[model samples]
Target: MAALGLSGCSSSEDGGVLTVAGSTTVMPIAEMAAEQFEEETGTKVLVSGLGSSAGIEAVQNGTADIATSSRGLTEAEAATDLVTTVVALDGIAVIVNDDNPVSGLTMDQLRSIYAGETTNWSEVGGDDLQILVVNRDEASGTREAFKKIVMDGTPFDRSAAVLPGTGQVRDVVSRTAGAIGYISIGFVASDFTSSTVKSLAIDGVAATEENVENGTYPVSRDLYFFTKGDPSGKVEDYIELVLSDEMSQTIRDAGYLPLSDASYQARAKAAGAEEGGDAS
Candidate 1:
């Protein structure tokens, strides 16, 4: 993953080929946007999912034109020359195997479960099977967001099986009968009945796009595209395309929450109010 953006320069020399690398959570939208941008314009965009931190590092090291991050930047990171733009909002869904009967969990229950305090499904109103905890690796932005929002800074159980990406988490939870994991809601199948893993509501709030848009979901986070400096030329045009109405359907089709004009303005205002605050 570290080698992903090592060869690319922040500025494209041929007036094409934008290099983007970052969060797997943001990779789908970036790829979709890239394809659309490429077709509409002549610029070619290359994208990679190399974890959030690595993405930022790529930008800082001049290896990438843009860095995608699921979580916001920290104060130290924000203080750097890099600039961040909020592209969308996403909900982190807590998922379990479809065989698990449990439909919801309170915040406390979720914290306890991840902390290794509750080891049995029965303790959470499920079948009497031993719980299998699946976690994201340390480099993942999803893992960082989950730890901050769900665990409240508590460390995950050491015994939890840590995987590298959201896809792996979903795959593991789908196959392991008692497994529990978390992923961006965008990766979840819209046809829940056919999906092998089921997303659980947290504290009665469902993990749906509508819920995220309405601010009713508890585990939502902003997605970002970071630039080493203010963008120009094709890079600037690409960012405009991503934020424009042209990409609204693209965002939804990718299973992410698309911001309306009002929502976008509101988010921008809120972000402005918190400038220099710790993000990731």
Candidate 2:
């Protein structure tokens, strides 16, 4: 298997397109980054939104150059020469229909709701209506992350609607009355703005750049780009380019928080700080 994005970035490296797959939650940032990379370098970067597991699988099976993910690969997924790179921090937002009146949720409340214990909007200071739950499909890293943080290994309620992709989850919650879902902050479009559906603070903490950066937010995690082994050739070049200060700016605009100068500088300064470093 081939790995990419470190040390070997000769401008004259192969000009062919590199295939990437993973997290829909990371899709917007990946697309924008790829667009800029293509414009500046004239090399293609094709990204797919097939969830994190699929992306890791794609790399492990020799089908992709990079795998983008909002969650880290499971230990089982990183066997052999596979390498993992963390690119940015993402704040996971709890979303409900605009009609819902809740402004925040305690972590315990979130767990109860997703686990189907709190099934009424009234239970969380909303309209007295049955609460509808929308969830990401099993393959989603966002799903796993949400589960890991909120559910604590407890099973999600079988009755909760498990939808595919972040887009789908957003759509369902936006349309369904009393619906609630979790999505990346970036996807909270204008339609959701000023709507009855609003983002809820988790554990009394809001999901924001300030909160995420200071580690005040309860639902935040590193975003990733995975490859097989140490990156070399064009892969190394691209990953290096992404770690630049300019790229961190892109990270913030993509609705994730940028690593601080100190944080990013330390990361960049590390040896072999490719896509597979401890925190790429």
Candidate 3:
């Protein structure tokens, strides 16, 4: 991996292309950043939302310069020389059709519903309508995070319709009367006042950015950008720009928690000190 990156360095110096592929959850931010980076540096960045697993695989095969993921790597993936960088923090919001009377769900109830134990809305304080479950495909980092954080040891109901991306799951849920799905909170905007699907509270706590930052949100996870060994040249530069103070507002505007919040306090403080020194 390092050899591939070193080999590509010469090309990067000549305004070569940088390929980034990964989680659809991270694609929007990457696309926005790519636009700005291109404008400033004149390097062409090719970004694709091909699911987290695919992105990791692309990096492993030397096809992609970086991979964006919403979940941590598996044991097998961690064993490789790949490096992980936490780009931001996000919540996995449980969403239901706007017409669904059901609002919030307890963690246990949500587990049961996904496990096929609770099949109807009435079972969890809603109408008598049959519950329709929308799920993301195996390749999705969002699905993996939901499985680990929300499902825990419980297996997902095989009968649920599985889509390949976050947007697809949300779209299906929004159009289906009894459908419920989980997606990155970033995609939902500030709230669901105008959306066809509304977000639900988990264990009585709302899936808001504040709750996520305070550690009250149960389904929150760190967003990531992965690379083969360590990044170099344009790859390193791009990652640095994404993590820099210049991108903090962009991260916030995209609905994900910036590095200034939650677990990133120390780093944020350090960054501030460095900026202050430079100014002085």
Candidate 4:
């Protein structure tokens, strides 16, 4: 299957196949944007989920046109003098077993739960049961977001269940009793029916699109696309395509909240610079 995909990518003529890499958290949106881009402009885009760090490496090496990231890279990335663009915003949501009675929680309570201090749900207003924690892999930006928000500057409990990816986190949480975890809104589907996992409110605010867009979601973050310095080629076009109206529409379709006005305007500026560079 990988071989076939490579072949397909190699066949593009509009501007040659544009290679992109990055976080699995942003892969679905990038993929959807690429599909619509090809449909509209006859250009092809090749996207890969190589982990965010690996994607940054790809851009630094000129191996990819763009690097989609859920979290910004470290200082080392900035030291390279690469150009970064904000393409979207996302709200990382805390998901719990639907049957669990506890709904909203303050960030402080979350920190206690993940720290293994608040073991009984009854302590948080739910039925008596041992607290079960599910976490994303360390490399994932989703995990980082959780750390910054829910963990309250503390580390996850060593006894917690750690999954390799967002999908795995979701799957495990959905089926496991007393499960609680976090995931990007995009991975959620209508039939994710384990019926076991549901979204929980953070700090008295609900985890809905409206809340995320309105800045009520405490865990909201900007999504980025990192590129090599002074983008001035087909690569630039590919990045610009990500902010197009159709691309924005796809984001809405993915069940994730759209970017706020400031985010949208910033992306527009970045796109203009990039696309214009390709022109000159």
Candidate 5:
């Protein structure tokens, strides 16, 4: 989908406006913050989920004021002077349909499955069913993170059906037996323990928030907000609200790791130390 445009009055009297575009994984957090921000101040925050690459491009082209991403910038994108902020922490959950008897897979087995070398569930200890691998589209930050953390240097199977959003991947896997896909841990629950799909453990480790916090989860990542240099005026104010203590509970309620969490604090420091540019 195309990025969302700024809507409503642009005048300061209307409380100003800001546009956010990026990862679907980060969209829920941004949307929640936007509502609270609008209620607290009169500013109109327009948010969209067009994938991480699109969001970064929107900021570079002056179409968006802020960009949210689920993965770190590439060497080329990092050279563009984009200032990064670690907004939250998350884990990528590998999911299958509830009917599937298989519970977990080793890291090597997972890599092999996605790489198309393990085409049958029986190869990994399940029923004698053909494995249907679902994947995210190229623009997805989740896909990039998966490639780095799970696939390592291996390419995805050409036979996999690549969809565009987290929801699509989740839905497809939920209905098709033997289908498997990965998505943010926050998106795992329809209502915490009541999801239609089942999250599988990796290397005998469950995909839980606690596992992510202790650094045991095999596929954890930091969620980000990128700004073109330092933000100022209303844009700055809105970001401050999102990062503030008042928003911590809102973030937690939405199933994300808020900045107040000790685990996120540690991850944030490391990410901050590695960044060296601002978006121009």
Candidate 6:
């Protein structure tokens, strides 16, 4: 996907506009928040899902007011006068076709499967079929997080099909009988009844918001929004709205864990401190 271009300044001169671009995982939540913000504050918010790397670049190049990332920024990116606010928590759920009888997987099993060490479903107690692996492209934050949390520097199978975004991964896995892919837990339904893809529990611990928040879920990570510098005006307002209680239900509905008061306060304090230091 291409970067979303902003009209004028990050905030328009008229009613104001906020441009957000980045992670497909964060796109849905940002769109929902943008819609609410536009209705409530009359500010036009443009959001795009061009991948996390593109989003970071957009912010760095002053093309976007905010960059929404599913993974945390690296130290190099953080050093470039950027401020990241943790807007929500997400769990990376390993998903498979609903028709698959296998329910859960151990971390070691997961590692082996992705690493090309296990090629058949029967190797892990499933039907006798070749396991088709689907993976995100290198630019995807989801893929990066999955590697860090699950693969532990191990590479994906050479034969794994590399797709661009979470939607593609989910769609592909849902239809392919022996296929498996990982995505943000929010992409999976809270309940499996309505989903074509089913999220697997890692080591018997379900990927629930409560589990992610409690640090029991094995594959959870923080979702972030990055600004080129201290957020002000419409950018600040939009970030505040995302972290507010009003958006808690939206966060849940989007399949993410809303930040607690303590988390929210800590992010706010950290951003404030960074801004203060930058001014000095």
Candidate 3 structure quality by residue, lDDT tens digits, 67-100: 8888788999989989987788789999998898
Which candidate ranks first by lDDT, i.e. highest?
5
lDDT of 6 by residue, 89-139 (tens): 789999999999899999999999999999999999999999999999987
Worst 10 residues of 2 by lDDT: 3-12
True lDDT of residue 67, candidate 5: 89
**Whole-model Cα lDDT per candidate?**
0.84, 0.76, 0.83, 0.73, 0.85, 0.83
lDDT of 4: 0.73
List residue ranges in candidate 5 displaced over 4 A.
Answer: 1-3, 7-15, 191-195, 267-280
TM-score of each: 0.91, 0.86, 0.88, 0.84, 0.91, 0.88
Give me the displacement of residue 209 in model 2, in angstroms: 1.9
- In model 2, where do residues sit more than 4 Å from their true spots? 1-15, 190-196, 263-280
Residue 62, model 2: lDDT of: 66
What lDDT score is found at residue 216 in candidate 4?
A: 66
Cα lDDT tens digits, model 2, 43-98, are 77777788888877777876777788888767777556778777777778899877
Q: In model 5, which range of ten residues has the least summed lDDT?
A: 6-15
Question: Superposing all C-alpha atoms, what RMSD in Å does each candidate have to the true structure?
Answer: 2.9, 5.6, 6.3, 5.5, 3.1, 4.5
Ranking by TM-score: 5, 1, 6, 3, 2, 4
The local distance difference test score of model 6 is: 0.83
| Order of the predicted models by lDDT, top scorer first | 5, 1, 6, 3, 2, 4
Of models 2 and 4, which has the larger lDDT?
Answer: 2
What TM-score would candidate 3 get against the native?
0.88
